[model samples]
Target chain A: MQQNDYTYAVARIRFKETKLLSDADLDALLSAKDTDAVMRLLHDKGWGDGTSHTSDELFSMEEEKLWSFVSECIDDLSVLDFLRVPNDYHNLKVAIKCITRDIEPNGLFLSDSVSDAEAVYEAIKNRDYNALPEYLRDAAKEAMTTLLQTSDGQLCDIIVDKACMEHVYRLGKESENDIIRLYCELFVASADIKIAVRCAKTKKKIGFIRRAMASCDSLDIDKLSSAAAEGYDAILSYLASTDYRSAIDAINTSMSAFEKWCDDDMTAVLKPQKWEPFGIGPIVAYIIARQNEIKAVRMILAGKVSDISENTIKERLRSMYV
Target chain B: MSEILNNSGLFLALLGAAFATFMAGIGSAIGVGKAGVAAAGVLSEQPDLFGKVLIFQLLPATQGIYGLLVGFLILSNVGLLGGVEEVSLLKGSLYFAASLPIAFAGFYSAIHQSKCSVAGIGTVVKKPDQMGKALILPAMVETYAILALLISILAVNGINGIQV
Candidate 1:
């Protein structure tokens, strides 16, 4: 019923996207001598200015700073922002887990909307699920119940991830703005495809895969179900017959390659819709571009730190805008 | 005699042509405005891609060209050229018919097409190499306007109002 205010948002987004990681940034991140060297580069780029920590502290600090910067850009709450949902889900999951484990609530939880962080911590500390916010109440409870029943940490992790994916997928379909819809669909589809590949390759049972795989707007779910049941090979064949055939071979060989394939496919589909002038297309596109840049940087840095072959790392790199 | 056809009706036909062209031009202008902003944004980020994004931004202007072409075709058929100068009712109607499509179609289509280009700018932001795809979506939206132009041009050519 409401129209999107893309003009203001896209203008701001364009400026932000310009400041994102470039090819040089990726190269620098990949060649860094240590975590300190990477942190210094981030500081130069106006990221994590106040942090002088390392290990988990450094990662969490930079992550929080990034989330806060993005959260600040959002002016309207009714717009159904997709950028924040992943962090929200992650934070909620962390809170619930910390509670169940009876551990000190770490700073891994990050959110702007949730004011009562301590209440969440206390709820987790005391095993009191009733004290959390209403918005996250149902999802947290559902995930917690499942976790209690399954007791498999991986299953719990997948359930939380699926919930986040569902949030993104549903938001895409409900949105009237075509660009936003495209972005939401693309993101969900990538997540879906990645899960499908993992589920198939690991030879996980259909029940586990069913709980793990969330529906995306672009994927034909019926086709995916049949393929998933038939295992990884069947899923790859099914994908080959569709628009994402470019990803099928990669899915068969390496999980990392499959992950990169999803990213590339999303970029390919979204790149085609960039010329539209009004609504949320530009904003969504800019966000997606930024997400890809961050992922590329993280991948390159990880590859370098772990001493992976440069050729292998280069093969894993996604496309960067001019 | 043909005196009535020779004067006032010719003016009316000319007026219709101008009006159609003017309206359609407005749509193209707005679309160009939006696409120009997007192009400028992309150019600033990836200066090397100015040429590619530049072409994408210009694609939506085709709607305006369609309108202008329709207008000119109508004028030529009204014997504003080197032909007989008598304008009949049928000739006036033909000019009006020619103006109608480009007038309405160009204007409306231009707005929609420009909007698509604005969205296309985002595509440019992430992957400048895909600028062609981005522009094509809007170009698809402007296809009907091109069809309108063709219809009007053919209709205007069929009019025999003036042999001046």
Candidate 2:
């Protein structure tokens, strides 16, 4: 489709962006006395549906509201498969484990996945791979078989996660939109980096690390796998040669800090789209930004519930898109 | 051949007027429709901003009026409305040539201006207080359309005075 086709959607997203919590807003939420105060503050900001809700209820409602608003703006929700694919894979993981371990999958599935989680579970339960989406058919069958035959849940997870990354990367490559392509590249590359770092810390063999990491143009899976097998210092040295050199500090600080850096990096990349007036870029950026905002709020609420220090929560907060 | 030549000039002159009005009108329709979609989107979120967005939607509509004005001028000049019913082939062709500037310029400028207006509407959606700045960007596109209008008007008047 032409870029002009998204003009109306982009305009609405522009207005919606104004409602996103700024850094100052995050500070206020962070400094709030307790969970109740945080909930009250969010309610004042038009969160939830003008009803009393617990923190989880409020966050879930807000997430649903974001998707509904997006659905209202966009005629075809498949254009957002990049965002929904992860949830689909997550559900797949949950379903596989639940089926293997003989447990109910209640409350484990995410809402708004590209495919229905229960449907996925049923298809898996019936051992009918064809019922699933074509992109997911092979991965589902392989992961399920690997779990059943080997009784290795970790191996099953690696298979599913790699498939998810590959599918996401292929979708990105096929997309004509630049922003989607960039997002997918970053998503896979970041995931690979995280996998490599974890494997390095755990002292995994090169072959195992190679099996888990997905390949993308931005990062070489072979070099990354080798670096991961070598150690943390080698991984850092390898990252310093790539576009992700700036992420070294976060990687050095803590795993959580690195996670925050990855999100903030995405925010920084999407920040420019705020000024963009026409195209899918701004709309995609807004969706990601809203997701980021919700994540930040969830973190703050979780921290408050646990009585974590304000400074620590502040440290983990991501840069807002607005 | 001579009969065809004698008739062809009036046909061409009328064709020119039609081109000017039709092309520009199509452009304006597209431009205004695009801006209106954006306006509707904004209004859906904040209905109070209707007055501001309405102005942005109307900005692209002026190109159609300019096209109509030029078409009317061409019709009157060619005696198609009310005047001596005969004219030399040279004068008819001259009138046809005169309409070309607006015909092409109006068609392009309106569409480009609407893009600017749509972007401007997005600006207004975010920062209502910055309407003045937002409006100016699209209005700048008007300068080119007006320039084309001036050239077509001057050319039509000059053609009328020519004694060929």
Candidate 3:
């Protein structure tokens, strides 16, 4: 209410909040008998267009609907670029790789991103890096040149990924909103941890791991990059000494469990925004919650379709915001 | 200058009434506009909750009414609504001083109360059944405004009796 600028948008979002999936709702979906049962449950919740669409199609529809809904609520979409910029980096990676290999980037790019996937692909196709945003031009050019010279796809990924983290870090520092700053912080730090762990697992050199890691306020690059070079245990030790000591249990379990931990932690941090009456906090929280809902439903549907154990899917599901 | 101001009782009294009217009126207008925007948002989603959200949209309106009442009292007391009154500068200054409580309080309280009303609307949006609890929060803000209104009324009436 203090943020009069978003009073109308927050009120609309408040009404929509009633429809978000609660823990009980998620449990009901988990107990659903089969894939059709799950889909029916979703339909009952007013999800998807009324049609016989596949699970993927339904999730895609929901994503489109969420984006459209948020777009209506906000005046400027750039405030949420922290959420969408990664997709630009992802598209850049896909374009660079596919252009080098002369393959079509079908079903490999994310939509509703900062940069259009097709435009990025065309820019790479025509060797026009300047056509991209200034923030992305250097990353695109460097990534393309590296892949062209060394034919190292992973190096290109590191370049683009590092650029994405730095962009996100700058956004976090520049943002006036607390939620945006916190989200960007977590995004960059979580990504740095994941990259460090992966590079360590693959026995990449210290310098390579260091190069891939981005600087964030919460995590020390020197400690994390070096810890990663030593191996998984050193990385865990470094994390244990820092704010992420709680993640040790998840790390000890498996990579998938660590991913679930990250998401669950973020959701827990964002849960208080459910009570927030106005401001960008609740809007950002709603967007994250909707995405969480879609991911949870996708997990359940994928689990039911593949006949995976219900417990396996349950383990992967992040905590619901409501 | 002394001679001019010595006969400016009607002017001072009228200034007091205008201040109370416009200051409080402006605050209520801003508050009502804020709450109305929020209510419209809710109505867009849940048209069935029209009766409920309308209460919040109208909560700020009372301050404007209170302003009108004080303005009317001041106008009628000085005979501005009918015959001209030959009031002393001292009495008119007292009338202006007396209007100060509600003039400032009504303005501030109305805006603050509307914020609570907007937040309450959000609560009702999530839980339509808890309208009672939601209404109580904004209604509590009215206590100060009412207190200010009472003091202003008492002071205005008391000042009218002074034979200056």
Candidate 4:
């Protein structure tokens, strides 16, 4: 692309980033009496204006309206393209659950970016194995096998989730674009880190971690698996060897801090590197920076709603840059 | 021919290098000037964040330095520093062609980069601390100019038998 067009894109992006809720905006949103006040607050910022005047009309009773408004302004198809992996996995889980429970597909089908929803639905409904992707076929087979042997639906969910993570991890590694690769890597790493922390805190057996573990682009899976095998303290010891060492003390025996650490560190790493020349780094940086800002605002609002101390909230906030 | 080549070639190469460097510098200056004005407008509205926005305004200026460095490298390699006056037309034109892309691209991109930084500064009008992230967008854009500068420098040195 020409320099002018790239500048134009950055211009649009800057405008979009500014419209995102700031700390003051979050404060107003939190102080609102109801969803009505929230709508009015957003309306003040030209949000949902011209279409919905009433608060009741704007209230995202089902998350659809909110996502639609967001989708409207940030209309880059790439965002939807990126989200398909997670949403598709969710849909597959819903499908499998429906088939086993003998439920109808009416409310169960997902609105995410499926090329042909009917095809996936029919394939699942009819149990005609050839229609599905190989991975999905494998997952369905594993779910059925697990179901028949153990009669444990939770086990199926775990297996499917692990399969989904593995797919995402593979996609991250295989991606040719550096930005997409980094996004996928951070995502997989965060997921693996979360699972490891959860298992450690819950004292779940090593078998559960092994079942859930998928390779990530950032952290060494072998080391993580070994830590899981060795136990919680050992995992902490291993995590301490990375840039996340600052988080070890905070985590102690808790997973929350570790999760927060991953989020912060990912931003910290990506933020500085965004200054490099060329090939989607700036775009990725801007998107991630905006996401971080949103997350930070959400965190602050959550704190305010709970009346948590400012100091506590500050301590819990993730790094603005990776 | 070698003597004619040396005199004209050296003059043309030096002229190309100087013009390219000047052109790129002018473009960057114009870009940074515009961004600086916008930043000043923003800073006036938010006095406390002047320091942050100013850095963003200055980032567009680096392309000029890069161009100058490339120009200097080319000049040094032609034995211009050794006080040899002029040489081959072929060598000089080759040097000119080699240096032109970065200089021109640097000029155009620097101007564009500043515009990005300007828009970014506008974003910072309400969010002061985001200035660093905002400036990075332009810096990323300016990176091509730096790479071009490096390539031009390498190419001019790599060319052989100009006869100074």
| Candidate 2: pairs in clash | none
Order of the predicted models by lDDT, top scorer first: 2, 3, 1, 4
Angstrom error at residue A245, model 2: 1.4
Query: What is the lDDT for B17 in model 1?
Result: 83
Model 1 docking category: incorrect
How accurate locally, in lDDT, is each candidate? 0.69, 0.89, 0.87, 0.66
Candidate 1 stretches greater than 4 Å from native: A1-4, A28-74, A77-80, A112-135, A217-229, A272-277, B1-164
Candidate 1 lDDT by residue in tens digits, A77-141: 44546666666677777877876676766656665433356666666556566776655566777
**Best candidate, TM-score:** 2
Write model 2 residue lDDT over A1-322, tens digit each, in one string.
Answer: 2544788788788789889999999999998999989988998999998888787888789889999999999989888898999999999999999998999998898998999899999998888999998878998999999999999998999999999999999999999988899999999999999999999999999999999999999998899999999999999999999999999999999888888888888888888898887878898899999999999999999999999999988888899888
The best candidate by lDDT is 2
At residue A70, candidate 4 shows an lDDT of: 38
lDDT of 4 by residue, B22-109 (tens): 9789988987876776665544335676777787788778888877887887787677778764457877888888778778888888
Interface RMSD for each predicted structure: 4.3, 0.8, 0.8, 7.0
Best-to-worst order by TM-score is 2, 3, 1, 4
Poorly placed runs, candidate 2 (over 4 Å): A1-4
* Model 3 TM-score on chain A: 0.96
Return whichever of 2 and 4 wins on TM-score: 2
State the TM-score of candidate 1 restricted to chain B: 0.85
Docking class of 3: high
Please write out the lDDT profile of model 4 over residues A1-322, one tens digit for every residue: 2332233333334444456555566556656655556556676775554466544333322234333533543435443344456666667777777777788666555564433455666787788767886757787677767876887887887788887787766766666666667677767766776777777767777777878777764578778867866778888888878755777766774466766776776676666543342334544566556556556655655666677766676666666542
Candidate 4: which stretches are off by over 4 Å? A1-8, A31-39, A46-82, A104-119, A133-135, A176-179, A201-205, A269-279, A282-322, B1-164
